[model samples]
Target: MADIQALRGVRFNRRVAGPVGPLLAPPYDVAAEFTDGGEFGIRNIEASDLGAGSGNHALAARRYQAWLKNDVIRADPKPAIYIHRHRFLLQGVPVERTGIIARVRLADWSERVVLPHERTTTGPREERLHRLRAVEANLSPLYLLFRDPTGEIRDLMAAVDANPELDDHDQMGGAHRLTAASHVTIHDRLASLVAERTLFVADGHHRYEAALIHRDECRNTRTADRDSPSEFVLALLAAVEDPGVIVRPTHRLVTGGAANTPDAIMRMLRRWFDLRPADVTTLAVDTDLVGRVVLPRRLGTWDIFAQRGRPHLELLPLDRGPAWLSLGVTAIEGAVNRVFSADSEEVAQHLFPVVEEANAVRDVEAGRAAAAFLLPAPTLDRLLAVAEEGDLLPPKSTWFDPKAPAGLVISDLRL
Candidate 1:
């Protein structure tokens, strides 16, 4: 069972603050040009004290202090879970995603209530820990997916959306986008409905991981037995069926070597599996398939990628490899591991996988990575299957779109 509770959120005083855009920021891990001078630039969140060192850590600490002291950000009057709605378009298709922003009980992996899909890297965890120490607040919301069997949660979400107490509007990429937040206390009658579901994390694996570390640190530092608010980490819960959420593929960018042509890539790939030449001219791959990602090495022609793992993609369905080992992403990772003789350190430095197809190809062509491996997006079903099997998908395998913006309803750690 999931524990969902509304707490007073920290927010900026809109009247005192110039504009929400200056305070609103993308999630900490999101890739955006910070140096760029624009409203959506990374400076918004930089106002938060990130930490006391150089690089992102120091920058984030100093900014956090500035925001707090300048009254750029403030805490809400009471505890509450915010019902958040993001209206956006993908490929010109309009979608409205809804979820509740709240503080969930901090549970270890053993509890099996809050689940994570990807593995977290140590570097990000350390960076997050630094930020947590500096701000003592949840800088972002974890994306959680829930299975609402009774449809009770859906009804509650609908009721909340209809009569939201706070409606925040922003000019997200030109068009006006609206985000509505309401107190969970105002809708306290639905607590039972919120607690009945299990949440699968769609994003913020590092945040959840950071919570575990923070909780441990608190337990060790207590001079006396006391109930500290850090017991619960902040999160945003959306029933899986929420319309505003969309899962998009985070295209892979290969690093470390040369920009190989389609034929060269095929020749190299043939050592492991059979080859299928996709007519790059007409059979352009759809980049948005949730789990079944495609790798298109644009060597004057686009090559369609099909990994030999999934039920649909496993054309041969060989009986040789371990069942879990046969996932397409895993296969690709294995191949890269062998080809580059990649160690963990090198993997972090040069051979990074990106989530955009064009960016991946460009990076390789521009001599950043040796080759780009584009993948199909994993379906939500596949993610759940992997978790139930006590396994994790390859890192950066899935990209949850319409990620919740930070600073809408900040969680106060001291409370």
Candidate 2:
């Protein structure tokens, strides 16, 4: 059974802090990109003591204590599950993703209570572990997907959404709301709903692994307390059937050498896969390519994009060289790996992954990256299937939309 429960969350004092939309930031990894000229940036906490040669994790712990002392943040009076809602636009279409934030008992992968879709790198995992050791707090919530065909959780969240405690709009004009559900009756219903369900880590795989590491370390050093809060990690549980949940493509930008010239790269791409020039006259005007020719997993059809002087190439996927790579994104990665010596350190340096298609093309035009190989976004079903089969995907294959903002509901490890 999946053990999910509420906990006392530390939050910013709204009276002293004013609006929290500016205060609530995305996770540390993606927080840097969204930093504005604000005094309450979490980057301030994560990077303040880095230059003095002090370890970041220790500094993070100190910062947390300092913030608590200064009334920058305070813990809730009672334990409760937080209802989080994000309303934003995707390709001009409005989307709202609602989830319940709570602490889940950490379980081993062998136990299969919490699962992962992508293979995580050791460097990130270790870094997260170090931070966990020093701070002993969950600064951000990991996004998890659970099977909920009957919308049991959704209906419950809807009732709470009617009257949220905090409702504010972020700088990007995205709506964010937070509400508490402290009643045991509702809590028990939710716990029972997920008692037999498995959670798939949608993002923050490294942090989840670090939680396990910390749990194990605590076990070896001291007597194991099965009921201790240290055995849990913060997570935002969203249903797999949420229509707003969609996977976006992160296109790869290859710069320098042959990639600098479309002709040079075209010569290499043609050797293994059939390339046909395609005309894309609808990129700028069409905000959402709902009716465009850009379709993924459609056999023998993938678009290769370049600047004005370069020839546009499309893949003839009729022959994928016996690889059962059904998705266009997977096929592109396969061809790029086979045709280009991506294994070499020299080639890897020039490669950059970007989420925006317009930005990818702009980088190539402005001479930042030599060329960009554009690929369509894969369906959520396709991504889950790959994970279920025990197969791994290439780096930057998927990017979930409107990253769940951090700093809203913090899980205090000391609790």
Candidate 3:
């Protein structure tokens, strides 16, 4: 069983942070590009050269402190689950997503109550653990999805949105353009429905794991009855299908590897894969391109392009299995590791989801990457199924968009 609770959150003190845009940054795990030395345009705002911890995390902590000290970002007087409303554009279509943002009691992974789809690296986990301890609060909210087929959860969210208690403009980027949010407290009516659903880790797997580790560390260091905030992990629980949610494909870049040429890749893949003229020139445009990916041992020597711009590659599985090779992620990982020396981390670092397939293909034709691999989007069902079966997907498998904005709400770990 999982335990979810309403928590007293610390909101951004508008005085010190000024406009939210400058303060917002994307989640640390995601590839975030900052301006100059220290500032990013993403909603998970942070300042400083080092993103997660750098002086940036520290700066975020300081700003959090200033807000607390001056009552800039104040804690809710009562413990309550906030009805978080995020309105944004997805694929040029305007959409709104609502979820109850709350502190979920940490569940031991051994218990199999909460599952993580993607794997985490040690370096980033350590960095987040340190920042969390320093700030003693959650700067970004983790994304969680639960099976809410009945409209009950949606109705609950809609009711909260009907009469939101707190409404604010995120105004993250310049021109004050950013996702708009509305935060409402979850009253007694929806508590039962929320407690019944099993939560899936849509994002923030690393942060949640850090929470467990931090909690154990705190238990050892603190006195009895310390009531450490690490006891609860900050999360947003939403339905599996939310209008504001979007999962984008992750493209893989093959450089400096044996799998460079198409023939070399095709020959190696012939054991299980059947090659055909993918004739799909517009691979990048169709976010649904699914095909087996193969490259020669010398993948580094040539250029691979997608959409005619940069080398874009998508991987589809040639084989199926209940134990392995059934999923595209599995096949791709095996091919990379067995055929080339690329590991999971290497795949994560090198892959970029095909943004424009045609443009990317042009780049390949012009000699950019030796070859590019494009893949189909990973569905929410596939992710949950993979985790439920006690398996993990390749890193950077799915990119969930409209990421929970930073600075909107903060969960402090302090007593």
Candidate 4:
């Protein structure tokens, strides 16, 4: 069963911090531009105070403690589950997503209570573990998805939205509002609603692994109690059925390999795929067909291909599982592997994932990459089904838009 609890959240003090917008930041992994501010806008938690660099962990710890001591941030007196509403525009359309922010007990992968659909690398896991030990806090909440068909969870959130504790906008012009539900009865009800459902890790695979490692380390040192803060990780839980739960495709950019040449790629893919000519203008207007097109740099043309037939599945690489075969990324990986005699890791090294089609094209046109493989976005149902079947997808498969930002609510382990 899933174990969720309310947390005494720590947030920035408006009087001392001046404005919440400047202090807020994107997730650590995607905050490269924010982290390069030197010492000017360096106050953003994701940049210098969080896990941005290897040698900055100790410095981040000192700055965090100083902030708390000087009233730059304050912790709530009562424990509560926070409700966060993130509002943003997608292709000029307004979209809003709501989730519950709470502390969830960490469980091993074998336990099957908490499930992850994407694979993680060791470098990121080790980096996050060091940051956790130094900061002694969950600087950001992990994004999680759950099933809520009865609309009971949505009803509960509506009541909490009547009043908001913190309202602000991010650097991207997205609106954010946070509210706390401190009543013990409300917390118990929220926990009960999700007790039977398995929690899926929509984001934060690395941080989740780091939390497990931190918990074990504390136990070995005899410094952890049954209810130690290390036992739980901060997370934002949302229903998979929510309309605002959008997933975007991540296109691949190929560079410096046998598969980089247009003629070579076409010849290899023709063995299993039927190729057709496609115009770049048609692809630009219709995203549905974008996944099927491949653009080679300096070729000034694009080709769309479809699998010839449901060929023998046994002959293909079935190690990942049958569910993975339905994804566009899986097909691209299979083609690259068969053509170049490479494995998944080797293929990953030569291909880069990009969220926007324009960006992918720009890289190829600018000579930064040799070719681009545009992919289709996966639906929420397809992603959830993949997770439930105990299968894994390639890294950076789905890009969740309007990512939940850090510094909104900090989970201080010392509390």
Query: Cα lDDT of all candidates, in order?
Result: 0.61, 0.69, 0.60, 0.77
Query: Measured by C-alpha RMSD in angstroms, how accurate is candidate 4?
Result: 2.8
For candidate 2, lDDT tens digit of each residue in 1-415?
7999989998888776678887766676776566661665555454323443546777778878888888888999988988898888977888989898999999987777787766566767887788778878888888888888888788978886677889888776688889988888878888888777878777878889899999989888977799677899998888889876767777777666654355545555555444444455333222122111122222222334322332212332343331225554455454455456555234445556678777876776665754676666666776776666555555556787766667888898888
TM for every model, in the order presented, reads 0.81, 0.83, 0.78, 0.92
Candidate 4 or 2, higher TM-score: 4
lDDT of 3 by residue, 1-415 (tens): 6666666777654554454445554566542554422222333333223445456666656655765787756776766777777666665566777777777878777777788777777766777787787778887788888887878888766655555554545443211222212233344445567667677888888788888898888788886242457788888777888766666656555554445455655544544443444444333333223343423344322221223321112232333324323444555555555455555566555444454445445555565655566666666777777777667666656677766665556787763
Give the C-alpha miss distance for residue 169 in model 1, angstroms: 3.5
Candidate 2 — worst ten consecutive residues by lDDT sum?
A: 287-296
Off by over 4 Å in 3: 15-23, 30-59, 165-189, 224-227, 258-263, 281-325, 341-368
User: How would the candidate models be sorted by lDDT, starting from the highest?
Assistant: 4, 2, 1, 3
Clashing pairs in 2: 255-370, 300-317
Q: Higher lDDT: candidate 2 or 3? A: 2
| Candidate number that wins on lDDT, 1 or 2 | 2
lDDT of 4 by residue, 3-54 (tens): 9999999888888876676566666777645643333222344453344455
The candidate maximizing lDDT is 4
